[model samples]
Target: MVCVKNLSFRLQKIILNDITLSIEPKGQIIALLGPNGSGKTTLMNVLADLYQKYEGNVHDVGKVQLLPDYAYIPEDLTIRECFNLFGQVYDTFNIEKAIQIFSYLNLNQDQLISSYSKGMKEQLHLAFLLCHDVDTYLLDEPLAAVDPLTRDILIDLIMKFKTNSGVTIISTHLIQDMDKLFDEVIFMSNGKILLHNSVPQLFEKYPGLSLDDIYKEVNRNVPFN
Candidate 1:
């Protein structure tokens, strides 16, 4: 499990405000749902330990695993280079899984990521993340810049990861297409959690409402300030 207490961060302005939340261990996927600049990505960065300029604490409470690590794929890395770099760093890279995904995505190992299309780059990033063994996976906008087919593939991998006991956290703005995969959805606005609920409980409280509809409702009724 991961816990954050009294977390407040600022980047030229406040991004997260005294946010305290805990993510359960496994058997679930958590969706950090928010619009652009709503602090979803910022919070993900904090959890990933990509940013230290913040107040409060982030504690990883779990067993004595060999590698209590988190993986974050940068958008700039090449497909081939990222594999080698991460392989050397993590030492637990899933080469077989990587090969399978590469073949499925039709990505050549020699090709530079700079030459690939946006969709292909996204595919490469997802492939890299899947081929790594990590306790927590923090993905930012996993569904963006992809065609429908690639989107489905990404979702499939995420589900597979969750089933295997990996704590997965995804930050995304594409609500309608991605909401069904979330076990729990965290709605954020103006750098704070406006609401959080499990998928079933969400539907229970707001009867007959889709995730997208609930997002709109929350934005309308929940003041950002």
Candidate 2:
């Protein structure tokens, strides 16, 4: 489990404010839903320790009890090299999974990262993440650049990946097609959490509304800053 208290961050001005939440690595997928520049990526970066200037207390319950490694797959990287780099870094890296994902994606190990199209690179990045056996995963708009077919495949793979014991947080603006995969959803607007609830609870509050519909209603009158 991970505990976050009074978390906040800023660039030239405030981006995330007073965010507090607890996450458990119980094979559950969580969605960070928001518009662009709504601080979803910022929060994910902070949690991944990619940004240094943030005020908060993030505590992981098990220190020596569990592996200390985590995986964060950015949008760009050399596919083959990334696999080798992660394999070197993580002792528990699963090469078999890597082969399976690569074969499924039809990615050539010898191809340069710069050679692949945007969609192909995104698929490769996800494949790299699956190759590693980590406790925490922070995927930032992973499906944003993929084609329809690739998006469907990646989403299915993510669901399969979440069947293990790890905390997977997927930040996305495309909610309708993928919302069903989330056990819980965190809606953010202008850097603050608007609502957080289970899928059933959210639908209960707004009857007959799809995730996208509820999201539209949430930020209906609010203006982005």
Candidate 3:
């Protein structure tokens, strides 16, 4: 479980206001939806321990694995080498499972990361993260550059992880493709949370509205500073 109580951050006098959220330790996927600069990435970074110079408290209740937006896979290293490096960093590294994920994502282990396509690199990064057995996975825009077919594959991979073990927190603007993927949705503006509810609850309250529609409606009226 991850809990943020009155978390706040400031940059150049622009404040990311108090935010409090609690994530349960169950087989659930949470999506953080907001426009660019809406503090989705900032909040994810804080939760991932990438930024510590913020007010309030961030409580990480279990082992956490973070996949940032520009998640770095050394361009000079081969896919296998990258896996080996991550294996050394994490205590529970499963090389066999990594290979399986690579195969599932149609990634070539022998190729250098620089030689791989953007989508393939994303897949490889996800595979590398999955090798570690962590309780929570924070993914930022996992499908940003992925092709349509690969997007489905990546979504399947994420769902498989959630089904097998661990909870996932995905921060992305691709709401249409995420309707069936998320158990809960969190809407944000600037640095403040505007809405947070279960998928079913949201739909029940606003009938005939898609996630994208809700996003547009929320951001249209509420201008983020």
Model 3 steric clash pairs: none
Structure candidate 2, residue pairs in collision: none
lDDT for each residue of candidate 2 in 1-225, tens digit (9 for 90 to 100): 778789889889899989888877787888889888899888877776767788977778232111112334432555677677777777867787887777777777767777777766666667676666667777787787667788988898888664367678888877977887888888998889888777889899999999889889988988889
Answer with 1 or 3, whichever has the higher lDDT: 3
lDDT of 1 by residue, 81-176 (tens): 777777787665867677776776677776666777777666666777767666777777777768888798878766754335657777777788
CA error at residue 113 for candidate 3, angstroms? 2.1
Candidate 1 vs candidate 2, TM-score winner: 2
lDDT of 3 by residue, 117-181 (tens): 78877877777777667788888998888888888878888876543455788988788887789
After aligning candidate 1 to the native by TM-score, how far in Å is the CA of 109 from where it should be? 3.5
Worst 10 residues of 3 by lDDT: 159-168
Candidate 1 wrongly placed segments (more than 4 Å): 61-82, 104-106, 110-115, 161-163
Model 1 error, position 46 (Å): 0.7
Clashing pairs in 1: none
The global C-alpha lDDT for each of the candidates, from Candidate 1 onward, is 0.74, 0.75, 0.80
Measured on C-alpha atoms, candidate 2 has an lDDT of: 0.75
**What's the TM-score of every candidate structure?**
0.83, 0.84, 0.91
